[model samples]
Target chain A: MMVSLARKTLLHEWRRFLPAMLAVSFATLLQLLQAALVLGIFGGAAVYVSDSNADLWVGYPGTQSVDQGRPIDGDIASLLEMNPQIESVEPFYLLDGDWRGGHGTGGVSVFVSGVSTRPGAMMFARVLTPALRARLAYPESVIVDPADLNKLGVQVGDTASVNGHLVRVVGTARGLRALGGADIVTSLQTARMLDPAPSDSGGPTYLVARLRHPAAASSVVADINGHSGFGRYQAWTAPAFARLSVLFWLFNTGAGAGVLFLAVIVFVVGAIITSQALMAAVAASVNEYATLNALGVGKRSLRWVVLEQAFWVGACGVVLASVLAALLIWLAHSNNVPVAMQPSVAAACLGLVMALVAVSGLMAMRSMQRADPATLLR
Target chain B: MPYSNTVIDPNPMLVAENLTKSFTSGQLSTRVLDDLSVEIGAGALTLISGPSGCGKSTLLSILSGLQAPDHGRVLALSESLQAMDAKRVEAFRLHHTGFVFQGFNLFPALTAREQVQLPLQYMRLSAQEITRRADEALAEMGMAHRQHLRPAALSGGEKQRVAIARALAKAPALLFADEPTSALDAANGQIVIDLLHRIARNHGTTVLCVSHDPRLISHADRVLTMEDGRILDDSDRGAR
Candidate 1:
């Protein structure tokens, strides 16, 4: 009976309750989009590790993120190659560089990734195909993501200066994007040539290894770390390293804090607007409530009616938000805006929305106190 | 001529003794029901008629347990209303009483049939019995054909009839109506009064109504005329 009454009233007076529903929908959409954007932005920081084919990454100790990699002893590669589980090991050079585009276009900060030009190299194996690797084999030739071409003021066949050394843009790739700066992809030889410091000053920034059996990566990493004979470095499974990078950026950065604050504000504002709208709706029907009271409906029963109404309102709002969020997410993807939504994050957002609705329903119960049967006689 | 202050009945459903009620507005206080006493019988349509502010509505409120009297006590269905707590009073009302108001306070969203079924739903009746009672009450009020229409679609009289059917569906022992016909046209008012009369005589339910309209005098089995919070006359016209 409570369900029937609540539903019929909402359907009959839909215009009156639309504001409350929309308030809930707006809150839900904001939470979902915010979470997606946060994941996408932070997830970008780990693209180098995630988009590679490496089963294990051996980097300098305490390397918090892939972009923050330090030079590790090149001798570490031999140690990895000696392991029975390791099929191949390659040196990966990651260095910060300043790019000066041709014709005085502009100067931009960039992360230079220097990898082997071998067709079967484990480093960036998924992104640098055979053709791109062949192009990078040319002297001082580099690759950049097409999306960052304008940011770096360069186009294919253009020449640029990296750390005061001239380099040619041989091609563009899709996954070579970096956080906080553009990415420049070149061969290990070119990167050594472009370096202002002596080539032998430090070894490669990190060593990446491919395993004969991918599933043995965790045990192999454990064994490598336990043996301490491998120089001053740490080894991690590729997934663990990627997750470490993402978590570092998400929790240890100011931008991440700002996104968290925005989420709090969305919840507060959504609760206020939704509760007020629900209260007004209840107040509008106070007379009908009074009539019911006069007919001997108890206060407990009346409270249940309000709760059922809130539940319906929240259900409808969630449906509306799902549709709208899907469209918006598609639009963001088309525009190359980084937005990622995991199933777990979406479920958590849904639980928050239901909690918001429940809080609003409890607040709206105060209006039932006005349903005094004595007022009806007057 | 000597006027009787109370009606004599063999089967009394409501008895009030020296009921006193007052209202205060800032510094001014007005007495609404001044030490009034009455015995209303079962199976009769009783009307308490008076001008505005004469306390007829207050009397009905006290008799129906909607309000507590300041000075005296009321007994409805042989249970002392003042002796029970608020929850007990509500439970008693839920189980034994029905009400109709001047505004025909049917929920605007509900159809005629839904309105009739609302209180029965509160009673937690079986679905089959709820539907059966609602249908029976609507048919009795001649609202069977229009049972699917909402309050907005129904005419003033039709809305009132729905309100009455809502009350009647509960099969309460006492049905209270306040200004039930004041909002209706002459013909619709006639129809409502006749229905109230029929509900009392046919169902053996006590129908107590408070109204200011003198035209309702002819339809009531008894009329208690009031002015300034005191009953001036009680006349029984005999069963119609």
Candidate 2:
């Protein structure tokens, strides 16, 4: 019966509740899209780690993200190969490049990732097909993300100069977008040739190893880190390195702090608007409430009616927001905007929206105090 | 000759003694009910009739436990309403009293049947029993055919009838009506007064009504006329 009254009232007075529902919907949409954008942008910081099939990554000690890698000794590859659990070891080169397109576009900063052109190489195995990797075997051949072609002022089969070294765009791949600039993929020889100043004398920035027992990567990483002989570098499971990279960018940067502040603002503004609307709705029905008060209904029962109405409002808003967010995410993807929403992230945003509505309901309960049966006489 | 403030009845259901109530706005205080006393009987329609601001409504409010008098006390069904705490008084009202108002005060969002079922929901009755009692009350008020309509779709007379059904559904020992027919036409008003009279007689419910409508005098079992916060006449018209 309580549920019946709450539902019936909302259905009959939908116009009165539309503003509150819209407020909740707007809040949910903002929170969801903000989270997705944050993840999509920061997730790029660890694309190399996340997109690779490597079981473990060996890099310079204290490396926070893949892009911030400092060259470790090339000898680390042989040490990994010596482990019986390690099936293959490969050198991975990361370098900063300045690009000048053939059309004479201005120099653009780019991160050049050089990997083995082997057919079954672990590096970027998920992102780069075997055919695309084979193209990297040719000297001066490079692959870039299609989305960044306009920024680099180059297309496939066009020639470009990187740090005074001429290179050709052999192919274009998707999912190679970077946080601050475009990503340029090439062979190790090409990366070395493009280097104006060879940091660490042309050594690989990191060494990636494939394990025979992929599930044992954590134990292997622990054992390798415990060895005093391998002090020049650190060993991490691929997932851990990817997570570390994303977290470093998310918490250790100004951009991330700005996003966090914007999220807080959205929450505060949403709460205020929603609560005010709910309060108005309650005030509009005060006479009806007073009548109930005179009919011997308890104040506590009236309070439940308000809260139940809020719950329905929130539920309807969430459903509307979910549908709208899904469409917006699709539109963003079509436009090459970085936006990604995991199931867990979506769930958390929904939980926050409901909590906001609950608080609004509690604030709206104050209006019930005005339901004085004595006033009905006047 | 001036009449006594109290009435003699074999079955008095509500008794008030020297009730004094005042309203203060800023510095001026108007005494709405100054040292008034009355005893209303059960199983009959009792009307408190007076001009505007004559304290008839104030007297009814005190007797119904809707407001507390600044002085003296009210005893309803042998229980002192002034002595009970707020929660206990609410419980007492919930179990033994029902009310109808001039505005009809029905929730616009609910159907006639839903308005009637609302207070019954608070009583924590079973769903089947609630439906049965609500339908019965609506039928009693001749509103059963219109029970599914919302207030906006109903005529003023129909709306008032639904409000009466809402009160009757509780089947309380006491029923209070404050200008229940002011919003209706003369024909509807007569029909309403007749229903109240019949309810008092058939259900043995104490019907206490506060109204200024002189046309309703003949239908009431007793009439108390008031002016300037004092009763000028307490006339027993013998059951019709």
Best by DockQ: 2
How much lDDT does candidate 1 score? 0.87
Per-chain TM-score of candidate 1, chain B: 0.95
lDDT by residue for model 1 over A1-378, one digit each (tens)? 332788898998888889989988998998899888887788889888877899999998989999998888888888888898999998888888989996565779998889999878877777888988888988999999898888878789988899999999999887777889988889999887776674454799889989999998889999999877667999999999998998899888877788778877877777777778778877887877887777888988888888988999999998999899989988987788888888999898878888988988998888889988777776
Report the lDDT tens digits of candidate 2 across residue range B2-22.
Answer: 122323358689999999999
Clashing pairs in 1: none
lDDT of 1 by residue, B36-141 (tens): 9999998788999988999999999999998999999999999999999999998889888989988887787889898888878889889989999999999999
Clashes of each: 0, 0
Off by over 4 Å in 2: A1-3, A78-88, A200-202, A210-223, A251-253, B1-11
What lDDT would each prediction earn against the true structure? 0.87, 0.88
Model 1 CAPRI rating: acceptable
TM-score of 2: 0.93
